[model samples]
Target: MSLFAKRIVLGVSGGIAAYKAPDLVRRLRDASAEVRVVLTQGAQAFITPLTFQAVSHQPVHTDLLDPEAEAGMGHLELARWADQIVIAPASADLLAKLAHGHANDLLTTLCLATEAPITLCPAMNHIMWQAPATEANIHTLETRGVRLLGPIEGPLAEGESGPGRLMEPLDIVAALNGAAGAVPSIAALSDKRVLITAGPTREPIDPVRFLANRSSGRMGFAIAEAAARAGAQVTLVTGPSQLTAPRGVTRVDVETAEQMHREVLARAAQADLFIAAAAVADYRVAAPADQKVKKTETAQHLELVPNPDILRDVAALSDGPFTVGFAAETQAIVDNARRKLTDKGLDLIAANAVGEQQGFDVSDNTLQVLWSDGQATLGPAPKTQIASELIELIGARLDATG
Candidate 1:
């Protein structure tokens, strides 16, 4: 579980992106969240209440005037139920209603009556998003301390492209986590420095060919976000992964295992905690071809050499940071993780299975955390949730040591 278990009310407004509500519900549920779905009448035009009911495993609340539900003022009942209310695909009309404190519908009525913090994810055409009215409404909401996730620039459903696209569901989750104080700012991390390596390192066999894992750096990026939220000053030494640097962290991008090793070693001395999450290549070409090797009908062989063991090297440092390593295994899960924990001298090792539907290139993941003292299992959930739990555990251990 996350450090906090939240009761989230997801309000779906009318928009083409209503189709994604089910995914949002699934993501939240995977994080061990208690979620309730409420939809506007306009929302039914895009997605059915049945879709939300299936994912949230709860009755969808839509009608503003259901007699039974309104026995005690249904909008007020729901308003009090939420720890947070998130308006996704918060359309142009919805923003206008919220900005003006309109209560014509159940969604607006709840928004007006609720004391929970409101978050909005605006999705619309670029022109609609940029119109003077929409911009003014967004400004008003922000001024009133409402959290805004995104109107990220992207290709729109209208066959036109600009900065009116809704943020990805994962990013929305991150934003919510941020708002809930899950990720601390650089000021929070100021007392302790963090070092993290992410993405997959390449091992070249020839001028044009190399070996690498399928790691997309999502997990590491999520960890960085979690760490930042916890108030740690983070320096991310990453390999090539197409991920934006989390706000308020320093990022250093590297390409090969050797390059990453140098960067990690240099930063480890100043770090209070070090997470070795990069999927580094185990071996590299013994000798590289000067030119790109052409395909041939004949069989061929290439010599290989071992790459530097980054975690072990950091662990061996005279005054190294608290070290955490990752074990991506195929079988013998716990045993293999324990072996790695002992062999690498890591303070902690997080192990996960990798194959067809397991780890690597997935938004969700599970982990087995092993240490000299004990072990804990996390997830069968989103990577973000797993990351948050891992950080909390680490914080507890750090407190114990102190």
Candidate 2:
């Protein structure tokens, strides 16, 4: 079946977006998805379950321990029933619950139990949305591989204009469908926000010397170009590279992994998709010497510390983004790549071998793309061509997921 026809559970938490739940149900139905509604206790206060029942033609599930809930195993039943779990108007409370892995209620408990892809569409006041606690929660969720949609910038109910608006039902559907590979529009990612990290980070050892790589940033740049051409709002967070940014793509350049980490986390929750292709330095000089060391010194024992794992951190976010990671392995290509995919909590990972012949500082590339349950391979072609095919695969995989 088309991914859109797959079963979905619409999780309505307490928020103004609760009022929009009926429209959301209708929209999912229109997409041919079999959507079941799960309302939080707070959500019931804002909108009646009957409203959802009227549109979905299925009973709404609300209580965690209700006897009427699927032979009294409602939570478990719903958990297994979902192909995707969409928490819309995901309030601060809901975000917090998922971030800390607190299954205190049916909605949160279902999130913990389901193997389905989870997408959170946050809605709240601008200040609360931007609060440090909320941002931290978002970062945690994203790192865990949950997909986060928009709290788009616009007028708010609290007489403010900023970044805490629940996404429109159509836009949310488009985002979900786009990721599922069902993007019917040729510009499948049109209006979708995409964040990409590329190039090699420089880890400094001294004023004059630093650790670096031979990455030319071509693959990441190509992906950004293809995404922009597909009508996505693309943000490129690149390490120091000689290449220029693609037209219509916003570029943010940094020299170190730490900087890249900050840049990515700051904007992660706001994105619909995140592709991390940067060959970030795994370690940096723990204490980079302020001044260059003089020549003729005995063998130096420079201490090194691990750099922030950018992809892992991004994947850690609770409602982060549709994250894609790239694995550059020199041996055991599939096994190593699959390990990274699971280890990093990525929605998808592109694996390729790197050496003098195939990848790294090369003009062409190839990839073995892996999701949690499937895989695909792209060619040993030019980086540009490889990027196009990879982007297509990404769209398809995303379309297939939640």
Off by over 4 Å in 1: 1-7, 13-15, 22-81, 90-114, 119-191
Every candidate's lDDT: 0.83, 0.84
Count of backbone clashes, every candidate in sequence: 8, 23
Tell me how far the alpha carbon of residue 239 in candidate 2 is from the true structure, in angstroms, after superposition.
Answer: 0.7
Task: Give the alpha carbon lDDT tens digit for every residue of 188-242 in model 1.
Answer: 2446899998999987777778888899887898788678757788889889886
Under the 3 Å rule for N, CA and C atoms, how many clashes does model 2 have? 23
Per-residue alpha-carbon lDDT of candidate 2 for residues 127-208, written as tens digits (9 for 90 to 100):
9988999989998987677777667667888788777888778667655765553223224477889999999999888888
All candidates' TM-scores? Answer: 0.72, 0.54
lDDT for position 361 in model 1: 82
Per-candidate alpha-carbon RMSD to the true structure: 5.7, 16.5
